[model samples]
Target: MLTILDKYILKRYLATFVTMLAMFVPIGIIVDVSEKINFMIENKVPFLKIAVYYYHFTIYFANNLFPIFLFLSIIWFTSKLANNTEIIAILSSGISFTRFLRPYIIGATLVSIFVLIMGFFVVPVSSEGFNNFRYTYLRTNGQQAMRGDNTDVYRQINDTDFLYVNSYNASSKTAFNFSLEKFDKDKMVSKITASRIQWNPADSTYTMYDYKKRTVGALGDVIVREPEKKTKFGFELEDLTPVIYIAETLTLDKLTAFIDKERARGSSNINIYMVVLYKKFSVPISAFILTIIAVSVSAMKRRGGMGMNLTIGIAIAFGFVFFDKVFGVIAEKTTFSPFIAVWFPNFIFGILAIFLLRNAKR
Candidate 1:
């Protein structure tokens, strides 16, 4: 059931959130545009269109960063209420202090759900447009890759059948490098290494350079062979997409898909993808947890008052960020489960929220 208080609080939070967004986004645009003003003028870009670009860019930046403003808004508005004795008045009216939290929880939950949806589905679609705009006109040249010159990556060419490298070239495909490792059941059965690999576009077959092939028979006998001619090998582009995407950029589905893709490809870089996917889910939930923690920390009026709450909130945000960052570094070096690595900070702070909520009640 919706209550009048819920409406009041929601209105207040959204109003303030939007105002802060309105101010901060324009400032960001002004700063960015100032640096590129000469570039725009040199291109003879019309002033009006330039202003429109800034407006769109600002909206995009502001939308991406809205949750942080939402958090701060709730904290600032609630803190103001407590400082002015408004929250105390509400609580002293024989309503349980916990009950006084209903409106806040409702508001937070609604916003959190909306933000999560926007983050997962909506934002990625928007990114295509945003990124395209940036690259097409704004000269984001680093988006493209150079063959043979970029970092080398390995990928499965197809269902346990072959492996490939599109371009080991950090610079050019001429000096390509790739390898194939065969596994039977849980055991490594054979291996092949190549110095330079070439892709055949018409035939969809890969060519190996300075390559050696080895085969392990069922009974453990090993055979090695070398051929002077470029042999047509079965391989496809799907195998290389994961590596290219990873080397290029990572998004939600892209990062998650890379986990399975890498394992299938027999690449050892699974840890990085694991961390990314875990953090995607974990970061949003932490925002919800932080809101709860803030409510608990700032509920009551005391000598420390709102300033105490602000300091504590800032400290807690920092600590949570620190915890997440440190855990991530450890997760990278060690074999820690990705979920635990990413979610532990949220778990720790959720406990802190519960503790503070109890104390605030007393």
Candidate 2:
């Protein structure tokens, strides 16, 4: 079932992909370092931390653009094969074009599995580290970036309980103009108001300033007030308002669970989180799709040779990235379906690949 040609192509497939990653990731790191070196120095970031950040950056960078790298590598090597007449000779020996695609499919399957694993497990960890380091060290207002939004926060704690805060301070870990309301079957049962609320981790309680509670009863309404009060609540402040990038920092299981929790809380950013979740699977599928497109485009020898193939490959790759980003932004900002937004690029390119493959076959 094995052949020398299949082995040769598969080897080149893997080697070229790795070579592209190796070549570009360092250049990415260099560019990033040049941009952030002043920030790192200003913040007095430790060298060890810097090294670790770049390590995570390498994984994050490579994983993000892996499909492009893969597409270019295939085009690079296959165009060489075509230009050298190796493919012409092989085709002359009676191997059909479809048969020539077998090794490519095998390579795509292998890379897809690898990409899936990295997206699900490895990339999440590195994304956390990469983002954390950037926010903590490189950003001028790192605390604000790392913390959730500060103004007009609202959350549904559960079916009957809801909360509102006028503003929150990440540095102080305080919420101003905090209000909590409880309802039983659309009738307000109790309301709690505090001018300022602060979490006391030492006692695992909330310290409320100018606190007031109002209870509604059949008999009448009763009100209680205190200048300062300390009590425990069912939720934590951080849980109510997580950082925007929190989804990217979680592994597959944790991300799923977090999304479910956020859905229950009626989060406004659910689309953003769903986009992130869908992309993990979509990126792997893209490996197969881009591989087919790359092979189809480069399999035929042209007058302009590898350079022409590369130019076309780059244009196609940029188009794919452009579609992905535009749809992703639309999904995050509007009511667009995240699933469609994530997969639409692949669908468009998959059709292009089919047309190109048919032409190549002809």
Candidate 3:
């Protein structure tokens, strides 16, 4: 059921996309290596590890930039067809314009599915390794590799329980000025304070030094003091203090669970997590949208030829990235909804795609 035109268009579409990815990814890696070669040398990082790191980096970078490349590839190939008068010849053979678009839609669908899989499952794992290597080798001293704005952390363990830590050292698994409070309805029931708390990973418990506990009753209050106490708390070390890249490191299911847990804990930066979650799906959907826009914009021969189409495509690509970043920052900084911030660019571009496609058809 496949026509010659369909095969030709589909083959060119996929071939151009892969060729673009192949060409640019090495340039990206070379530039990155040039920038970080000195750091790797100073840190005495092994050559094998550096090579492996760039392997993961390639996946991470390509996945993030696939849409831009996809857009450009479509514009390049379609412009070539237009310049060679293949489009006119096909239409003259009695093919409808809508029929001519079938192969493009099919190619877009394929790319979108691939992107969805990578974004949901593959990119998170690669991103974890990529970020770890960059943080370990590229950063100087006094800069914390973990993600957080403050040392002091406050969290709600549950509706009736709350926790506080004045400062936490993630490497040492230690906290200073730790406190836990429990309330029965609106009345305070018990409070525990410690000068220091340390996590014992072997037993999965925390040891509190110079600890004091106060229990309140209707009649009076009782105080218990100890030099050190070991106990199990409801929260883990990550629950107490999560790194900034935690959201980026989780798969879809884990990310959803994390967001639910953070929301219960009254986390203020839930929007940031929401943005990452939504973007996984939005980025793939944008591929289909951008493909339509690219095909439409470049399918007709122009006075300026392929160069003109590329210039327009690049401008549109940058604009799309700019909108995505601006809206993401607005959502993270202000109270804008992360869902809207993530998908608004797609919505705007979808309209543009329709408008351009209609004009191209006419």
Candidate 4:
């Protein structure tokens, strides 16, 4: 079922893509180390931890540039084939352009599958390590970075209870001006307020200062106060203070569950999380479109040769990245649809690929 030509092109396709990743990933690591070496040293980070961090960084870096590298590799090798007139000779043997594209399609399918696995499962673990290392060692406002929007925090715990905090400090595991209100139907049942609350991780309990509880009854209201009180709450610290990068650290199923939980809590960052989830699927899908465009752009022997083709290819690749980032930010910040933001780049470039394919066939 396999021909020599299919095997040859597929070999070149996969081999070149691997080589590109090998080359660029190391360079990216070096640049990152150069920038962060002083920070690592200042924090007295151990060498082994640094090594592990870069291991995770390698996956994160490669995943981010996967589509770009795949596009460039395809362009580079296919341009070489064109320059050698190998494509012309192959076409003269009566193979249709669509048929000639079969191996490339197969190669794209393979790469897309790998991308899907990496995006949905592997990259999340790497992202957690990469971001945790930065927040723990390199960032100045590490607590603020780890705990998103520590001020004016609010959460709907369940159908009957709601919570509010004026401010939280992740470093100290403390919250100020905390309140929990429980409702029975449309009426308030009881409300608890604390001037300060601190988690005692040693005993898995919370110590509150100036704590007060007010209960509403049919006859009247009853109130109890204490200067210092220790008790357990229904929620954990994470429920009160979720990290900004929590979405990036969760795998497909966990991410989906987290989104559902956040939705129930009426979180304002739903759009941002939606963008991340959509991109996990969209990034892999772009591999197919990028491969098609790369082949169409580089399959013809142009007057400007491989360099010209590469220039064009790189421009298109960056333009794709630019669109992706812009739309993603718009979705995250404004009310734009995350689905459109994630997939619009592929849709636009898909049209470009079609036009270029027609010209290449001519």
TM-score of each: 0.65, 0.82, 0.82, 0.82
What are the per-residue Cα lDDT tens digits for candidate 2 across 250-362?
78998899889879888778898999999989998998889889989999899998999999999999999999999999999999999999999999999999999999988
Worst 10 residues of 2 by lDDT: 141-150
What is the C-alpha lDDT profile of model 1 across 1-362, one tens digit per residue?
Answer: 76776678667766776777777787888787787665555556566656656655664576556645666666777888888888888777787877777777776776667666665665544544443333324422332222332344565444555565434322122324567777766676777777766656666666666677778777665755554336565444434433422422345666567567667766555666677566656766766687777777766666987787778777776777788889987776688876788889989988988888888899
Clashes (N, CA, C under 3 Å) per candidate: 12, 0, 1, 0
Clashing pairs in 4: none
Looking at candidate 3, the ten consecutive residues that score lowest on lDDT are 142-151
User: What is the per-residue lDDT of model 3 for residues 1-362, given as tens digits with 9 covering 90 to 100?
Assistant: 77888899999999999999999999999999898877787778888879879999999999878888999999999999999999999988999888999999899888989988888888889887786676556544534334344346777788899888875654467877899999989999999999989999999999999999999988999999999999998887765554456688788998899999989777787898999999999998998899889988998999999999999999999899899989998998889999999999999999999999999989
Can you give the lDDT of residue 151 in candidate 4?
Answer: 60
Model-by-model lDDT, in order? Answer: 0.63, 0.87, 0.86, 0.87
Per-candidate Cα RMSD to the true structure, in Å, reads: 7.4, 4.2, 4.1, 4.2
lDDT of 4 by residue, 299-333 (tens): 99999999999999999999999999999999989
Total backbone collisions, model 2: 0
